[model samples]
Target: MSKKHLIDRINTQFGENLNAGNTCFSSINKSKQVWWANIHLSKFADEVHLLLAGTGHFLWVTLPKDFVHNLSETFKIREDKNAVDLEISADKDSRYLIDVKSGGTGFDFRKYVREEVGY
Candidate 1:
């Protein structure tokens, strides 16, 4: 899916207005763009969502509940009773890694975009 499609999914599913012009957090000159949001997922807890979109790829993730306090600085997420700790990063090859840890169970997922549909 394209970047706009991703944002549209969030809007339709969550009833929130999220778009590149508003949520972007990085330099516009670069082909890749980063965005973030604090939103509630279904009836669960509120969480932080980070999105990275580029020419041929888009990476989106939902962090731990209520963990993102600021957008201008680097921070770490801590596991608490309400939610797990989540960490996301990307390698030089454009592979994205997601790590989530709770009381005892934790899991991870990786993504590397090969193509985007509906562009």
Candidate 2:
């Protein structure tokens, strides 16, 4: 994929919702035939930086701290509004990354297969 293609994919998924003073960054690995991009998703409380990489046929995404926080907040709000048993367990896997394959309409942690962090 070319740089433009990568950028367009991010734009299509995120639109112009990036936080103020933030922009996307990208690069290509000619040796491996891979393309990657770094983008920030805008939120009312914080900004989440995501890394998207495509290897000709498939694409993957890596979440940052803001993603975890945002997800946690979502659960917290849901629990507060409704009475239900809810639990969330997330480890600080600084090296954690997953493919955009099949989680849900968005990044799916349940279906994320560990790449290398653990066997």
Candidate 3:
């Protein structure tokens, strides 16, 4: 699927909760399977709940806002925006770099998935 198509799927899957209002951003690899996404937290007074549809697995992930506080501002998605170019590297400390093209930014959060939070 195309980038905009994929992002819309994710957003629609999370529509009910998104009533709180936040922008969801995403990017797809050339193969159109691998992808990375994030919800730009605004009015997210509770925790962050992500619905990654069509994965066939790990379809949902949830985390406290505090867990992503440091990198919260780096996430955003737009259909009109070009596919964001990205570069990643991990240091000895496991600190990874998410270099965005032309200064854009975002992510994939898996380990923090919580099954307990679901509709």
Top-scoring candidate (lDDT)? 3
* TM-score sort, best first: 3, 1, 2
**TM-score quality measure for candidate 2:** 0.27
Ranking by lDDT: 3, 1, 2
Q: How many residue pairs clash in each candidate?
A: 0, 1, 1
lDDT of 1 at 2: 49
Off by over 4 Å in 1: 1-5, 13-45, 66-91, 94-119
Q: Residue 48's C-alpha lDDT in candidate 2?
A: 35
**Tens digits of per-residue lDDT for model 3 on 1-119?**
33344335555865634322432323334443433543333424566544443323323455565665544254443435422233222221342333332344535443654432222
Candidate with the larger lDDT of 2 and 3: 3
Better of 1 and 2 by TM-score: 1
Please give the TM-score that candidate 3 achieves against the real structure.
0.38
Candidate 2 per-residue C-alpha lDDT over 35-119 given as tens digits, one digit per residue, 9 for 90 to 100: 2332222332333322233333323232334545344333322333332112211212421222221221223343332121110
Q: Which ten residues in a row have the lowest lDDT in candidate 3?
A: 83-92
List residue ranges in candidate 3 displaced over 4 A. 1-31, 36-38, 43-45, 55-58, 72-108, 116-119
lDDT of 1 at 67: 43
